[model samples]
Target chain A: MVDVKSVANPLFLREEELRQAIEMLFFAYRDFTGGPDEMLAEIGLGRAHHRVIYFVGRNPGITVSELLKILRITKQSLSRVLSHLVEEEFIIQTPGERDRRQRLLTLTQKGVELERRLTADQRERIADAFRKAGADAVQGFKLVLHGIIDAPDRERFDVSGGPTHAPVARVGNKIAGDKMPGTKIAGIKR
Target chain B: MVDVKSVANPLFLREEELRQAIEMLFFAYRDFTGGPDEMLAEIGLGRAHHRVIYFVGRNPGITVSELLKILRITKQSLSRVLSHLVEEEFIIQTPGERDRRQRLLTLTQKGVELERRLTADQRERIADAFRKAGADAVQGFKLVLHGIIDAPDRERFDVSGGPTHAPVARVGNKIAGDKMPGTKIAGIKR
Candidate 1:
């Protein structure tokens, strides 16, 4: 197991360290989403729509409620983005096998196309980052990121976390899978 | 020295790894910003406003053009959010002494209070994460985050980068410096 005793010590909880973490998140996230956001903006869809398309593409049969939870947006907010994708024929909604009232969402060929277009640049960036950080650093990177997550979402991480103990480069190559490779993301289980 | 050569090796790139990185960012950022976003929402302010308030508070003598580069948003968009903050007396703009045309932005007393209120929870969350990750993990985490930034911003990071090799806990204490103590932040220098 990772030795986390030092991490739990309060002496390290200085205010400056926390602020650095905050700025790191801000700058890193802005760049991480920048490529996708620019592309989405050009197509007249914002990040919200991108999120719907992404999750739906990842989990071909995800229900509307499940998507909402992952997004942490209300049904009303989700509806606007979902409706746009549906109207544009980028996504398809079908009734669940077990419950006709449940709407299962999936990407259309068009949705898949768009998702690829959006993710291509992001994939390259992520791959390079993994390569630069190396296996050990990558593991440490994931641990810190995972730790920052709230408990519930983290539980989902336990269920869906990618392959364990693999070299960091493998994760990147896997993420860039020929078919966007399997990010080993189980996504959210309904 | 970190053996980042492994990170650059193409053979190790896995699609799964990239996807995991994406999700980690998505989840971590959502949670990190959630508390402040809600508080901002309650006051009829959005994250855009919080950002302006934050940077201005951090760099009290920052100019408009400088702010624009940092935010990476158009002047028009910034104007809308900034006007709201200024009109409400949260921020004040003054002509630069060296360049009369340059408008320097700084937070008012009210703005400082708002910035603190908005950041309190975030500070706590970041401190906890640092404590959980320890000094070494925190360093790896920053490396990955720094790698993700675009070249220009990354260069800016070098200028504003935080401490080199100090314990993570020290960063927090240093950030709480009597006057926003300089933590070796790679902030953009104007």
Candidate 2:
């Protein structure tokens, strides 16, 4: 039992603080997606297309429903975006092994190339931030971000296990377990 | 001083980690804005109009150029959105005191009501996260998010001092400086 209207308090949600957080998400997400948005713009696509390419690339055999669930967009909206990607030969749909009626989505080599190129800057940016923040801060960052997500979508977000297809990227270091060596990540130099 | 291709190594861009971070951002931001999006959609407005109202509401006399810079959208695009907001009487523009040539954007009473309703969830979400993560983790959260923003926009992200108007909100405890007692705060109850 604590006092309700304590005059001078230490624990509170500073309106300014919350407002700053809102602005932070806005500016951060804006810049984070800025790179891909520009690249997609060159090809006459938008963030909608990027979302399709990214998810398809990540989950090799993901179904259209799964994608729609993940993206939270209308089937009709996806249909318009998908037609362009398919016509552009960026993504290919194959009959699902488990379900004959299902269409499994995967990116073509060109699609993979484009996806990698589009996300390269993003990857670089995250890697840099993770390095700068250190592993503990990264963990904290993830915790706070995870906490921000809605509970229903949290399950979809923790999506794990590798893609059903062969490896798209050479497995990199265990960033979480290891000391994030900041800039000098041992590898074929960029 | 580091080996390039040391086979079976422990340093590289952990694709899984980066992918998880990307997904976290996608889910977190999606859910974060979902509430406001729905609110705006009811009035036949979208994220664009929401952005206009938000920045103007937050800055309280922010110039159109400043708004344009923050949004990074085209003049024509903003014009369409601004027209709707202005026509609807959600926002009003005034001649600048000094220049008189500049138009200063502010939210009308209707605008303030809508803005508050639209952002109430967002404020609560952030407050809840800050409470859960505590102050230090909030710092980490801000740092990582700040790191995510492009260098150019970083300055704007750090805009300090109160909104250039009378108390828009009753100031609560300083989140950063305080120990963050999880849920205890002066003023405003759940």
Candidate 3:
């Protein structure tokens, strides 16, 4: 039988190592938001605004309830941000055809332009890191992140599969077989 | 020469991929803190308190000023958390040997015990993810995180090198050569 006590000790995580990870989280998150933050700042917007715009842009005609689920924020919190975006003409809300109580949201043309600018910066950063880390490492990185997700959220992630709804077959085959081409993963050319 | 315009196009990142990444960040961070958050909640403490204790424990006899630098919060903000920790006897403060104005801080026994409990949960989470992802993915994940950090903080990360003070050579070698052993990348034993 394997000895489990030795395996579970907290000391296993060296102090310096954990601290390094903490600092990395701080710096990386800051830099990740920096580009889009600047663009938003120019128009007196903030991170919250960017999130609402980005989600609406990604899921055109998505309901407010669905967005709240994806964002995991209370309706009240989301309402403040959504109100601002709508007032700014960055998003449009219409009564749901099937359920009037539900509001369907989509980005306006202006919203689309802004969303493109914000996400483009983020994509470039991820792309640069992917290229630098190489193909194998990218797979491991993504897998680790997937594993770190909460169990319930993981279920949601698997089910919803986000905006594209690319067949799970494609994602699974690519991940399991490690057949994700470097160029393809780098994303399609503009 | 590469085509710069092609790289600049916003369509390079599909809406699906971006949403997936955004979801991953939200879910991963929530799970990453879940274990510790539970422990803290039971003790009537929160993440902010845990952070103060962890840093003080890591750098025994560190000054308030240094702690502020690591935390990146205002004196008033740190004061609230620090006062509570001190009042509860989780931490002890002493006048600096060199500077009368400096207050050097260290964790008390209670603080150490609590710190251990919180960190154990976090370390196990990270270790599991590392093991599951394997050494290659772990390297990629760390590299990408490092790349995401802003330049100055990145320098701070390089300079501090975590609490272990493990020589950069040793740390780099361990990560690069697949020497980390008996660690899981994710999944709790229970």
Candidate 4:
């Protein structure tokens, strides 16, 4: 049994250790964003552009106000990226049916393709990491990531029609299973 | 026994779900940085500035070249922040004992106090998340984060002395063992 009393006092932990966590965050975040960033730069885009395309692709016909809420950026900040996406024909904004002042956003085919390209790279990375960590660790990673988000924003983490939303069913190994070895065939209930 | 045929096809996963993960990363990273950003803002320091102080505080005798490599930013970009830190007297640059061209960095007491404030906020958030997720989740989260870093940078990550270097035996609720209710301790082991 692990002796709880043997645990060192939390306050006694070295500042250097805590500082390392901060550096890891910086380096890891940079590397995490690096792949898509290179792709975005090629097309004269930035991370901001990727965000606009990604969100619109996820929620078709989402209004600007709703996007602002999710992004938590000023409308002015959103405008710069949104304009580029619109000009590039990656996103289409239409007048809202009820509120003409509201603009509804959707991804054009080109936008969808771009979003797919950007997201596929990210998914591959995440999936690979998930596979390496195994099922239990993947669950923990998601929980910790979810905890990092603000309470209100956490609700948006649900994928509209993904496995996360599906009912758990025990299944057998296939290609997906191969990628994530050791995961129980049963669907994760979350 | 779980039926292999019943398993969901990886190809069949909806694009929306992948997109949600992308957004989650953005929102969560923003939220994670928010705590330190607020404190830094009050002192006319941005994230870049905080990075300089953070590293200097972590490695008292680290050189400029070492810092640039650790930060992965160009020396020109680093110079701007380094100058500010030096001018403010938060960091002292001493001539290298062996190499006259190299300057060693150390944090002044004022710098240490400021650094503590910035990191304390972040540490509290990380500690809170860890408490919320528990030990297994914390380990998983770190594994995933480590995977996100570039392979080369992973070695550099080691030099930073992450959570592994934390006085794991410490028992107070302040660091990792905090059993407090509603406090989110999301462990990201560097």
Cα lDDT of model 1 by residue, A36-117, tens digit: 9999988899998888888888778888877787899899989998998999999999998877998889899999999989
List ranges where model 3 is wrong by over 4 Å: A1-23, A34-44, A155-190, B1-23, B155-190
Off by over 4 Å in 1: A1-13, A159-190, B1-13, B158-190
Residue lDDT tens for model 3, A1-190: 3323323554543444445555465456657877998989999999888878876776678788777866777999999989999998999999977779977898999999998888889877776766776555555556677666765555433322222223222232221221222212112221
User: Can you tell me which runs of candidate 2 are displaced by over 4 Å?
Assistant: A1-13, A156-190, B1-13, B158-190
Instruction: Write down the lDDT that model 3 would get.
Output: 0.65
Error of 1 at A117 (Å): 2.0
CA lDDT scores, all candidates in order: 0.73, 0.73, 0.65, 0.69
Clash number for every model?
38, 0, 13, 18
- Write candidate 3's Cα lDDT for B1-190 as tens digits: 4434423543543444545555565567767777888899997899889878877877788778767866777999999999999999999999877678878898999999999888888777777776676655555666667666655454443422222223222222222222113221111111
User: DockQ for each candidate?
Assistant: 0.32, 0.30, 0.30, 0.33
Look at candidate 1 and tell me the lDDT of residue B71. Answer: 90
lDDT of 2: 0.73
Clashing pairs in 2: none
Q: Looking at model 4 chain B, report the run of 10 residues with the lowest lDDT sum.
A: B181-190
Candidate 1, residues B1-190, lDDT tens digits: the string is 3224336644443654576677878899999888999999899999999999988887887788778888989999999999999999999999988779988888999999999999888888876776787666677777778778886666444322244465342222222122213211234321
DockQ of 4: 0.33
- Give the higher-DockQ candidate: 1 or 3: 1
Q: Estimate each model's TM-score.
A: 0.78, 0.77, 0.71, 0.78
Ranking by DockQ: 4, 1, 3, 2
